[model samples]
Target: MAFINGPVPEALDREVAATPAEFERDLRKAWPQGVRSDASLSLELNDGALRLTILLEPLEPRRIGLLTLPRLCARYRFEGGDERARTALLTRLDRAMQRGGG
Candidate 1:
């Protein structure tokens, strides 16, 4: 896992559970087109840091009549640092989620 040295905003921690759609939307935006698959998002908080992971599993071209397991496509970690830095990082993360990180 990679560590980003910065402060994690309290608001983000609160939103983690309150706004799950935000995370799902971001994952869908990051998902590749023309790929028949399903995705899952995982969030973890530890020691004032947040980790977001996107896992994708193909749905088509089934083998042995079983869907393939999801694979990690993206993993992001935000750490808590100074208030100013934390705010900046949180803003970036919010925008990235809205824009699908493209």
Candidate 2:
């Protein structure tokens, strides 16, 4: 009944330079319990009361000079969860998907 875990969004969208397969691997690592839906290219992580659906949309590769990078659009939908729950879960996912170096 108070603002504790900061602000939580019902949905989040992010564009990353990674192929579907690559991102899927990270998704699995982040939430192994999550189920993958190949048909829709989405992942569903649910704990009955708390649910999160991740939609992966592949886009044209970005070319910089002679380099081409894979592109993907990731949409995260927080179906049911508290601020702390959502924040904690998202943090794990973000940490798993995070990449370093230029």
Candidate 3:
């Protein structure tokens, strides 16, 4: 690349750095009521990837064989291979949240 502009600005870098924690906090606040009190929501950043984990508890009890599980969990990993990949992943997460995923 030639000389046009440098890397991401320091202020933008700080905002980006703070995004994950803010996002996690917002998710926790908006979590579904059906989720258990001990359920956890976390985010992990790796290179160009973002990993979100949602641990949920069923609204009602479930019995499988003779064992009973307290909650169910899912991990969604978004790796930005292209410009639109990140947008798509975010849209997917938004839809899931609107649908009350728990």
Residue-level lDDT tens digits of model 2 in 14-69: 88888888887777877777665677788788865778888999999999999999
| Candidate 1 residue lDDT tens string, 36-100 | 22335454323234333333222233235564422232434445555665555445555544532
lDDT (10s digit) by residue, model 3, range 1-102: 011133321111111111233445545445442222232443433324433333322223345999753332323444445435445444544554443225
- Let me know the TM-score candidate 3 reaches against the reference structure: 0.25
CA deviation > 4 Å runs, candidate 1: 1-79, 99-102
Cα lDDT computed for each candidate against the true fold: 0.39, 0.77, 0.35
Per-candidate TM-score against the hidden true structure = 0.29, 0.83, 0.25
Candidate with the larger lDDT of 1 and 3: 1
Which ten residues in a row are the worst by lDDT in model 3? Answer: 9-18
By TM-score, rank the candidates, best first.
Answer: 2, 1, 3
Residue 93 alpha-carbon offset, candidate 2, angstroms: 1.0
Judged by TM-score relative to the true structure, which candidate is superior, 1 or 2?
2
Separately for all candidates shown, the number of backbone clashes (residues 3 or more apart, or on different chains) is 6, 0, 0
